[model samples]
Target: MDFEEKPFLRECKDIIEGSFGAYLNLSQQIGDLVNQHAQMVREAVSKLYSLLILTGNHSKPDTGIFMQLLKPLSESIMAIQEFREKNRASSWFNHLSAISESIGALGWVTVSPTPAPFVKEMTDAATFYTNKVLVAYKEKDKTHIDWAKAWLQFLNDLQKYIRVHHTTGLTWNSRGTPATASAGAPSAGGPPPPPPPPPADLFADPMKSGPGGDDTRSALLKELNRGTEITKGLKKITADQQTHKNPALRSSGPAPYKAPSSTSQPVVKSVAPPKPPRFELEGKKWMIEYQSGKRDLTVSDTDMSQSVNIYKCKDCLVVIKGKVNSITVDSCTKLSLVFDDIVSVVEFVNCQNIQAQSMGAVPTVNIEKTDVVEVYLNAKSLTAEIVTAKSSSVNVSVPSANGDFVEHPIPEQFKSIFNGSVFKTEPADKAA
Candidate 1:
């Protein structure tokens, strides 16, 4: 009996192996089918986006709803495509594949429908699929969620792009009212102003030599100077975090209060610090020197109580007069200079190769005559961030580059990063 069963057992084994082989082949086919559907969906979305742009020239009856749905739909589609590219076999994932199929089916359903219905269906499917995918992503199997997010961003950008192009007419004022004059107001009937005559030559330069000989160069320089002054007011916020630690200007703490004989509610305790003077983060080269006569003057390395100056003579580099200050530089070619807190004046002459550092607390970056290429100029107390340039047509909008008045302090977040304890820590395992 045992000998007779051997052949049957071998036959059974062959049957099982053949079944698994067939199953593997079918699984692969299903995966390919899913990928094909995803690709088709992406194409459909791109076409829809284009159609929207073309049609959006005229105001839609329901423009707000259309844009709202369109934006999210494109975003979801982009997220889907991105996920597909990153995940080699996303289509084979049982749950994910089903969601992708449903989404793709929705595209087909909306193909010939009117904008209103199509938008409704797209919005529903996009939201549903996006949620499903997000859940999967949170579980650390981000295959579905990644695709959904990409698709969502795509849809959003498409809608936003269309909305921006089609929007027109005067914008509302701060009070949320139309900016045009009130319709009920009385009209001021007057003759229209005469139109100005065209010049003899349309292409002729306005600054061409006239009775007053060409003063174009001087006028242009003056205009350029005016623009520089305006930019000086735009300050770059620093990396310092502490903006409220000044003790000099802070108000005194509240005195202990005794409860009246009559029943009274207890006063709430305040957890925040007392009001202090707002101090901005100064850049490396310049620091806020003490408030002088009325205006703030920057203290320089050479002007310190102890002066240190570096000079180059006949090809020989020399520290001609003063002591060397701190030099700090980054790979980006940004450098900072730090000198004796007391120095009032420093000069660089006929020298190119230089290291940089940060001065202790001088407040403003004072730059003397030198052919420096690219430098970022920042004054801590003043509200301005500037890039200095030397070449022609290069715009350098620092404080003195085109002296403009600035009063606002740099933002605290940026200042904190630059002056924080964490930033000062030495590289170690702690960095890890």
Candidate 2:
């Protein structure tokens, strides 16, 4: 018989494919718009510089020139904003916001006279957004994830451009002359006087002019290179998807059994062995439990030097004690974890009904694609990434070096999610 595909998986795949296709198209359009804007600015600046050289006017270009250069940037920003509004319900909203912010920074830098700081900011934002996309891709089998990868490449290229071209327009050279002064002869007094030191706040605002600056040509080249790479990756994924087929199941041969010696020996009846108990305890060192005809396991560790890994289990529990080691949980359900002391890392993925308790030194919790129900923690610090929790009740109390438990304010993000329920720790009995 032919293999039948699961409806849910197929539906998910189709949704991902559709979303990804739309994302790819929109991202390409936005990228093209940005590139065009960059190109326009470059040409405008180059032309303006040449004209200044010919006319020997070192003053800033008329406001009309600035307005003209800014038009494309404004339009691109509007387009991105529109895209964000249209896809507000998308799973990629956070990613879209990051990309939009990066593009907005780019727009600001384009119109700014001193764009060095803004360039750096734009690069950082774009790189951050790219990293977020990568994280999403690693967590799910969504097609739009590939678009994120492409977007990142494009952002990296933009970053390169900003770094190479420190400034977008003409600036005073070290000799106090306009950089374009090379087009004319030097003064009779040997060389022109050295340019005065730049103002202390020259870089304070990216929109103002500085004495000297860099250009955008090399950065543009990098952008072009990355764009080509994005196209190639997109095409490859598309082709691979077209060629791939649903998986098929194959049958195994019949089970083997020995024939009884009928003639020589009296027939002995075969009896099936009894199944083991659902729960087993190996002294105080370990315990294992099986439920619902499947293994719902738990592993407890007391040694701080050892690491723990739990995977593909349901209704699982993990207990940790001692100094601290890393713990990783993946593809689990109804998980309950307790950390008694300091831990290097706590990572969870594709999990639900999670309950974690922390006592002593704080550990960073990295949760991805997991839904958390509760977390009770006491530590010096906690870091959560890509973690979603329905409710969090944090009672912060950090033991000082002198052994006094000092209160630390809950992080803003956690407080917001918990709706201000985070507070000072109560007595142990009361907390329970």
The prediction achieving the highest TM-score against the true structure is 2
| TM-scores of all predicted structures | 0.20, 0.31
Please estimate how well model 1 matches the true structure, expressed as its whole-model Cα lDDT: 0.33
lDDT of 1 by residue, 377-400 (tens): 344323322222121111222345
Q: Pick the candidate with the highest lDDT.
A: 2
Each candidate's number of clashing pairs is 62, 5
What ranges in model 2 sit over 4 Å off? 1-60, 108-113, 126-132, 142-146, 166-432
Q: Which stretch of 10 consecutive residues in model 2 shows the poorest summed lDDT? A: 194-203
Q: Which stretches of candidate 1 lie over 4 Å from their true place?
A: 1-34, 49-121, 166-432
The lDDT values for all models are 0.33, 0.45
lDDT, model 2: 0.45
Backbone clash pairs in model 1 (N, Cα, C under 3 Å; residues 3+ apart or in different chains), count:
62
Question: Cα deviation in Å at residue 412, candidate 1?
Answer: 46
